[model samples]
Structures are given as C-alpha cells and as structure tokens.
Target: MLLKKERLNDILTDMAKQARVYVPVSPDANDGGGVGKSGKAKMTRFELYSPGTAPNFDLVNTTMPPKDMLFPQTQKMYRYGFDTEGNAYIDIIHDSDEVVIFGMRSCDARSIECMDDVFLSMGYDDEFYKQRREKLATVAIGCASVAETCFCDSMGLDPNAAPGADVQLSPGVDGQSYVVVAQSEKGQALVASWQPYLEDSTAETTQVSCALKVNGDGLKDKLEQMFDHPIWEQLSKKCLTCGTCTYVCPTCHCFDISQENKMKDGERFRCWDSCMFSAYSEMAGNHNPRPTKMPRVRQRFMHKLCFFEDRYGKTLCVGCGRCVEKCPVALDITMLIDDIQAADLSKAEEVA
Candidate 1:
C-alpha cells in the first residue's frame, strides 16, 4: 500500500494519539542568544536536541542511533522488597510501551536487524530488549543526500532500500513530498486504517535518488588479507581508548551485565560495552586476553567483518561511517582501509 504526504501526516497524528510518537523534526535553526567568535560564546551542537524526539518529521539523519529506544541508557530491571514477616518479593518491570520511530535511515534500520539476532539469541536472550522489540515499529526514509564520510555503498548497503523497515518512503520526482510504501503487515494495516488521507501509488514513486557505494564486502576481504600487517598499530596510535566509535556505531552490539545490591535487595542490570576497554576481556585471575590497543582494535573489525558473518551469514557493519566521523584520533575506517589496500610493499626496502 502507498500513502500520500497528507495521509502520512494524518497517520502520524493517529499513531501519536494511540502511543508516544517520536518523529524527526528539525530544531530551531538560530539560537535564542549567543556571542559571535568572542566574549566566551556558548556554541551549540545541533545534535544536543534531535528531531527524533519531536512530533514532526523534517530532519535529515539523527546524530545518535535509535538503540536508545530499545536498549535504554539507564533502566530499572526489577524492584525488590522484604517485610518483617520474612516474605521477600521481586517485581520485574517488563516494558509495554508502543514506540514508533519515523525518518530512520536504512543503515540504522539494518543495525537494528543485526542486533535482533544477537539480543534474541538462545542461552542469553535479553528480556528487556525483547520487550522493546515487540513494541517498536520502524519507518525508514531513504537518503536524498550522502555525507562525505558515508560509504554504505561499499558494504553493499542501499540507503534507499531498508529491509528492516515496516514502512519505507522516498522523495517523489515532483519534490512536493514523499512516495511512501509499506513493506510489512503492520505498515499495510496502518495505511489501510488511515486510508482517508492516503492516495494511490504513481509513476513518480520509482524516481528516488540512488545511494552511494558502501563497498563493505570489498573492504572486508581487503581487511582480511591485511589482518597480520602492522597497520593497526600505526592507525590506532592516536586512539584515546574512549570507545566513542562503538557507542555511536549502529551495529556494535557488545554489552556488559552486572548486578547491583542495596542491603539484601538488589537487581541485575545490563549496559553497553566495547572492545576498546582494557577490562573488556579480563579474566578473574588477572589474565587479560586482549590487553593491548592493537589487539582490541583488531578484535572490533574481526568480530564485525568475519566472526559475525560466520554466525549470521552477514557482516555486522552497516557502513554508516559513525566510527570514522566520531573517532577522536581522526581514524577514518574507510580511509584506513583504502591506505592499507594501496600500501606499497616494495617501497619499505628502498626507504630503509
């Protein structure tokens, strides 16, 4: 089913009425008051307030991933209490909120898809993640403009095609609005229920702008070939071990689980973790497997590019380039791979 622009807004309003509607609405372009290049100015970061939390859908890409919606930064796992009568009880809080994420990019959607596989795996299924997954619905908007650091094309990811979205929208040729299409049963029901505002699909629906090359597969093979090379040490030298890359990445799924107690009453909690941390793989006896930065760096790529694929038949990276742009050392993964692929082996002897 297809929905026109006006119909889409009506559907959004209806969804909002039923549950919390989080759309991508652009923020105020100009600040209320600020100094210009002096006088101790309070500069603004547009990412500080994302449209993803707004009611209107008008922003480009959200600075942060939608993971916060599923795996919240801070959430209570369960509450416990004990009476003097010697009765103890624990109340586990399983989420039951309906959430709708609009204007999410295809890469971000794919990131969720990859995470579902991990979070829902047997022997360690996360109940919180499952609850969020059951209540969340994703609506993807195709990319009309590509960022310089974006290389989803190299990873064989299509910015215009979101296999994980319940509903997908592309800009129409007329440029007045979007050409929306439903990819899931939920989306079809949504369009059908909001049929009063929807319109028939037209020829213009096929004319969306193409996403640039991600080259993820090509880069994966090249990385595999150079796995044992010394490039990791050189590229990772300036790294601060901040773990910002994994935190921002859409498909990085490593996490740590810990239990907290308050005098006989306690709860277990799960939080985000990363390979960059020195304590990530440390054993109880003080034996650390991946103690060095280079090994940790190597582990990140290996897990995403090789190990994940072996398990799930697909690479974990979506080629969003968040790691490249957010790295403190200016370590661009794409540029790093490009440099490695183009490295001249023979030149080392002559230079020596």
Candidate 2:
C-alpha cells in the first residue's frame, strides 16, 4: 500500500475526525523548520493535529519526543474534598481519550516500549499511565533522513522500523509516497479508515541508514566494571544539572508526586522529576544519597545502560539523540559510551 505525499494532510485529517491525531509539525515553514523533503534540524516538534496543520514528514526527529502522549509532564491523579455537610470523598481523575500519534520515528516508538515496561509490566501496573496508553494508537513514519547526532540504528534499532507501532509508513526512495504496512490489529483498522487517501499500488521504501555509529556491544558489562573509575568524576565536572537531557529524552521516566489544596478541596498530581537534581536524593534526615555530581551522574548513566536492562531486559535509552542535541555543556551520551568502552577496566579494578 502507498500513501501519496500530497494527501498526507487529508489522511491525517480523516484520522483526526475520529481520534485525536498528533503529528510532527514544523513550528513555522519559513523559520528553517524541518518542512521540506530533505530534513533540517532548525526545530521540529510533535503537536496535536488540526485543520491547516503542516505536518513535516521529513523531520529526522523532533526536538521533543512523543512520550508525553502517554506520560504527560504533569497529571492529576485524583481530586479530594469535604462537602459542605462535612462529607469526605475522593474523586479519581480518570482522564482518557482516543489518541493517535502520527509521524513518530522508530526511536520514539521504542521509547514508548521502554515506558511500557516501567508503567505496565513487572507484575504491577499504574492505572493513570495505563488509562492513557490503552487509548493511544501509534502510527510511525520511518526515518528517510538521519540527523548528525542520531545513533538509534547503532543502539539496536532500525531507522526504518518502529517497535510495537500500530501502523508503519516507510517513506519512498523518491520521497513522494510512503509504503504503508499494518503492524497490529489496531493498525489494520487504522489503515482501513485511511483507504480513501491511500493508493492500491506499491512503492519502494528508502533504505536510509544513520551515518553516526557506535559499538554498544558489551556496553553494560563494561559500565559495570568501571563504576569506581575516575571517568565519572571527570565527566561530572562539566555537568550543569539543568535536567535538559531528562526532559528531552524519549525514555527517561522519573517523576515526583505532590498535591494542591484549597480550603476544602485538594488535587493530587504527579510531575516529571530528574535524578540529576541534588534534591532528588534528599530524605527526611536531609542526608542525600547522591549528594554530589559524580554519584548523580553515575546513577543516571548506570540506570540508562545497566540497571534498567537488568530489570527490563532492554536498554533504557532508545538513542533518539535529543539529549545530545539539547545538552548545554555538550555532554554527550555517545561520547560517554565511547569513553567507557575504551576505558582500561583492568587497571581501574586493580586500583579499587
């Protein structure tokens, strides 16, 4: 099946009529946004699609990941209050809507899978996250172009494939159409509804690959041995702890819960948090486990490369490179991986 490039908006519009469709949009067509056939990184973002939305399919990756569709930055878990008659009751805020994410790249899709492991797997489930996830459907548009920092392919992902996506749209070599394939039952229904905008023809998918490469093989083992190595100290010196990496990351899922109270009413909510902050480790006695930069930095990387994999059997990082592009101090995860792989663990162990 093929979806003509020109009819993308119409197809998206059709989907929007039934479900809330989110698309990768160029904030502005003339603002050096990722708008044309060949993608540019000026700025691309995911947003709710509506009439006149100029969906930029060529964007290699959005500055922001679509993980927010499932896990929002701030969510209201429930509302509690005492009635005028002094009756106490709690109102569970069940916010769920039929949503479809269109034009997410493979890495972003895999990030959702990582989130699924944390929120929906491991013998427990989060009702708030599950509610949103159950109602959401993914429509991934495979990458036809790669950003300079993209290393998703190197991190065990096909630039042209999305894990667990409902529908997959691989761009044509000529960038004029997309070869569409249904990857799930939900995808079948989605494709069926897109029949009017699709053509009963075939098109060759673009075989594009990321030029950036790194050897992630045995990275977890290498990181485990280098826990006490001086590399972390050296690396921590440059970190500003602004938490930009965690915010832009497609797979980072740390959060903190709190509440808002009025005279007789209150709302409990959870908001995104970052391990990079010193306050994250602060406890009742004011003793911070990861009080220093080195430990905090070490914790972040170790969790991403080793600890999560130990528990989930998958790397926490999907290698979307949002952190690499957005980090203020030029602290790059790929470089850290390279340094770890090249570190002399034998000598470090001897010193330890």
Candidate 3:
C-alpha cells in the first residue's frame, strides 16, 4: 500500500481520534513550547500531532531517541499520604494511554525491542512499563539517507528495515510516497483503519548505507578480556563525565527511584540516571566502586558491548549515533570499537 505524503495529515488526524498520534516534529516547527531536558531544540522527539504540526521526514535521525514514548524520563509510581487516624494510605498512579508513534527509524525501533527484553522478558515484568508497552503501536520508517555518525548496520541493524516494528514504512521509489507493510495483528488492524488514506500501489524501496562502520565481530568477547586494559586509562583521560551518551542512547535504561514530599503527602517516582555520573554508583558510606572517570567510563562501554550481550544475547547499543553527534567532547564509540579491535589482547591478558 502507498500513502501519499500530501495526505499524511489526514491520516494522522484520523488516527488521533482513537489514540495519541505522535509524529517527528522539529522544535522550530513546534510553537507549542515544550523543550526537552537537553535544552536544545527537540529536533526529532515525537510530539503529539496537531493540524499545524510539521513532521520533518527528511531528517536522518532525531536528536533524542523515542524511548520516552514508552519509558518516560520521570514517572510517578504512586502517591502517599496519612489519614486523620495516622494510618498511611497509598494511591497507585495509572497513567497509561494508547499511543501511536509514527516516523520512527529502524534503529529507534530496535531500541524499543531492546527495552522489551529488559521490561517484559525473564521471570519479571514491570507493570508500569508493561501497561504502556501493551497499549503502544509503532510505525517505523526506513532511512533513505544515513547520518555521518550512524552505525546501525555495524550494530546488526538494517538501515532500511525494522523487523521488530508493528508497521514498516519503506522509502518509496518516488520521494512523495511510502510503501506500507503491516507485520503484526495490530499493524494489520491499523492498516485496515487507514484504508481511506491508502492506495494500492507497488513501489521499490530505496536502500540506505551508513557512513560510519565498526567491526563488532567478537566485540563482546574482546571487551570481556580487556576489563583492566590501559586503553581505558587513555580513553578516560579526556572524558568529562557528562553522561550525555547514556541520556541520548536509546537502550541505556539505567534509572534511579526517589520520593518527593510536602508535609505528610508524598509521591514516589523514577527518573533516568547515567553510569557516567560520579554519584551513580556511590554507596551510603561514601564508598564508590567506580571512584574515578577510568572505571566509570570502562563500565559504560563495557555494559553496552559486553554485559548486555552476556545477559540478553544482543548488544545494548542501537547505534543511532546521538552520542556521537551530541557529545561535547569527541569521545566517539566508533573510535573505541576500532581501538579495541586493534588492541594487543596478549598484553591485556598478561595484565589481567
């Protein structure tokens, strides 16, 4: 099926009636005035669709990943207060809403899959995350152009396809249309609902290639052996411990839980946290496992390359390159991968 670019607004309008439809709107295009925490223009974070919302389909990737749609940066778990008899009471906050995220790229879609493995798999299931995940549907768009920092292909992701997406929108043979393919029951229902907006047409999809490439073959194995390598010392020398990479990373799911109180009333919430921060691993007695930037930096990369793979059989990084593009310092992960590939494992083994 082909959905004409001109009729995108109509389609969004129709979808919005049943669910909250989110489209990729640039901050400049959004006069609605809700900037993200990064303080930069919310370049590509999915925003609620309005008639005036202008989605930038030409953009290679969004400045921030679409993880916020499922796992919010700050979520209130429950509210607590005391009764007149001094008995404590709790009110569970249920804020899940049906949502449709449109225009997500292949890498970002895969990031959601990574999140699912953590939130829904194993013997545990997070009720908060599961509620939102159950009600959300994704419509991923294939990339027609690649960013200089993007390395999704190197991370075992296809630039032109997202197998995990509910609905896949391929770049059409022409620039004004998208080839739609529904991959799930929900996606098929969505397609059926959008029948008025779609046309039956066959078109060839455009293939996209990333400019950046990293050899991730045996990367996890190599990282497992290079835990105490001196390469981390050199890499951590220039690091500012800014935590920008983890914040922008799609699959970095570290968070801290806390409570806010006013007199007797309080609310417990969870907010995103980064391993690069000095306080991230700090203990109550002031005993920090990763005291310096060296171990902290090593832990961050090792988690992305090794620990996650060890547990989930998949790398934590989706390689959308938001970290590569937004880092204040030139701490490139691609360079780290290259260095690891070229590192003397014999010497690392001897040191270990």
Candidate 4:
C-alpha cells in the first residue's frame, strides 16, 4: 500500500486517535527559527505529535536516540514517605502508556532490538522496561538518503531496511509516496485502521546505501588480543571524557540509580550514566577499576566492538554515526575500525 506525502498528516491524525503518537521533529522546530542560546543548530529529536507537528523525514538520524521513550533518562522507581504513626511506606511506580513511535530510522529500530536483549532476555526481565516495551509499537522509515558519517552498511545493516520494526515505510518510485509494509499483527491492524488515508498504487522502492564504509571482519578477535595495545593510548589522548558519544549513541545503556529525599519524603530514580566518567566504575573507598582515560576509552570501544559481540553475538553499535557527527574532536569509529584492521598484532605480546 502506498501513502502520499500530502496525506501523511491525515494518516498521523487518525493514528493519534488510537495511540499516543511520537514523530521526529526538527530540534529547531521549537527554537523560534534561530540558533539556540549556545549559537549551535539544535539536533533533531522525537516529540509527541499534534495537529501541526511536522515530522522531519529528511534527517538521516536524530542526535537524540528514541531510547528515552521506553527507557527514560530519569525514571522515578518508587516513592517513600512516612505515615502519621511514623510507619514508613513505599509505593512502586510502574506507568505504561500505549504509544506509537513513527518515523524511526533502521539503525534506531535496531537499537531497540539491542535494548530488548538486555532487558528481556537472559533469564531476567526488567518490569520497568518491559512495561514500556509492551506498550510501544515502532514504525520505521527506510532511509531515502544517508549522512556522510553513516556506516550502517559496514555494520551488517541495510540503511533501507528495518526487520525489527512493526511497520516499515520505504520511499516509493515517485519520491512523493511511501510503500508501507506491516510486519507484525499490531502493524497490520494499524495499516487496516489507516486504510482511508492509503492509496492503491504500485511503485518501485529504492534501497539506499551508506556512503561511509569500514572493515569489521576479524576486528572483534583482534580486539581480544589488542587490549593493552598502544593504539588506545594514542586514541585516548584527544578524548575530552565528556560522555557525549554514549549519550547520543542509540545502544549505550549504562545507568546509575539514586534517590532524592527531603523531609521524610523521597523517591528512587535512575539516570543515564557513562563509562567514560571516572565515578562510573568507582568503588566505595574511592578505588576505581578504570582509573585513567586510556582504559576508559578502550573499554567504551571494546564493549561496542568485542565484549558485546562475545555476549550477544552482535556488535553494540548500530552505526548510525551520531557519535561520528557529534564528537567535538574527529573521533570517528569507522576510522578506528580501519586503524584496528591495519594495526600489527605481533607487538601485542610486547604491549601485554
């Protein structure tokens, strides 16, 4: 089924009636048509859709990943307070709302799959994450074009495909229509619901390819032996340890849990944390396992490349290249992959 670009708003309006709809909007959409206070262009992020909300399908990928929709940056776990009789009470907070995330890219859709492995698999299920996951339905938009930094193809992903999405939207031959394919029961139902807005048209679908490329072959095995290599020392030198990469990454899921209390009333919450931060691996007595930037930087890359592959049988990175584009310094992961492939392994014993 094909949907015309002119009728997208009508389709979205109807979908909103069934579930809370989120669509990608230009970060500057709310910036009053000017640069932000920092004098930099705002990065696109997903926002709740309204009648006039314009979804930015032209963007390659949003700087802010859609992870927050399911796993919020700051989530209140529970509330604690004392009764009149001085007895303490705790109220668990588990809020779930049915929602549809429209206009997600293939990489972002894959990121959600990575998150599912962590939260839903391996004999453990996070109720907090599970609730939101169950209530959410994803509709991924295939890429019509890619950014210069995007290398999803090198990561074994097709820029124009999202196998994990409930519904997939590919650009039609006309470039003004979308061929919608429903992959799940929920998605089929959604399509059925949007029948009024859809047109019966056959159009050729074009597959987009990423411009950037990297060799990830044997990279994981090489990383297993290159833990102590001088490459990390050289790479970590320019790192600012700002954790911007992890924050922007679609799959970096590290978090810290803490509580806020004032006058006998308190709430336990979890916030996003980065391994690059010194305190992330710090112990009770101020003993830190990863005490230096070199090891921290090495850990971040190794986890994305080697450790995660060993555990999940897939790399943690989806290769959306938000880090590559957003990194203040030229810390490109694709470049690092090439460097790793070119590095001599005979000196590994000496580094060890």
Candidate number with greatest TM-score? 4
On residues 160-195, what C-alpha lDDT tens digit does candidate 3 reach at each position?
999999999998868888999999999999999989
Q: Candidate 4 residues 217-301, lDDT tens each?
A: 8878999999978999999999999889999999999999999999989999999999999999999999999999999999999
TM-score of each: 0.83, 0.95, 0.96, 0.96
lDDT of 2 by residue, 277-302 (tens): 98888998999988889999999999
RMSD of each: 4.7, 3.4, 2.3, 1.6
TM-score of 3: 0.96
- Quality of model 2 by C-alpha lDDT: 0.88
Residue 42 C-alpha lDDT in model 2: 56
Q: Is candidate 2 or candidate 3 better by TM-score?
A: 3
Pairs that collide in candidate 3 are none
**lDDT (Cα atoms) of all candidates against the true structure:** 0.70, 0.88, 0.90, 0.90
Worst lDDT 10-window in candidate 4:
29-38
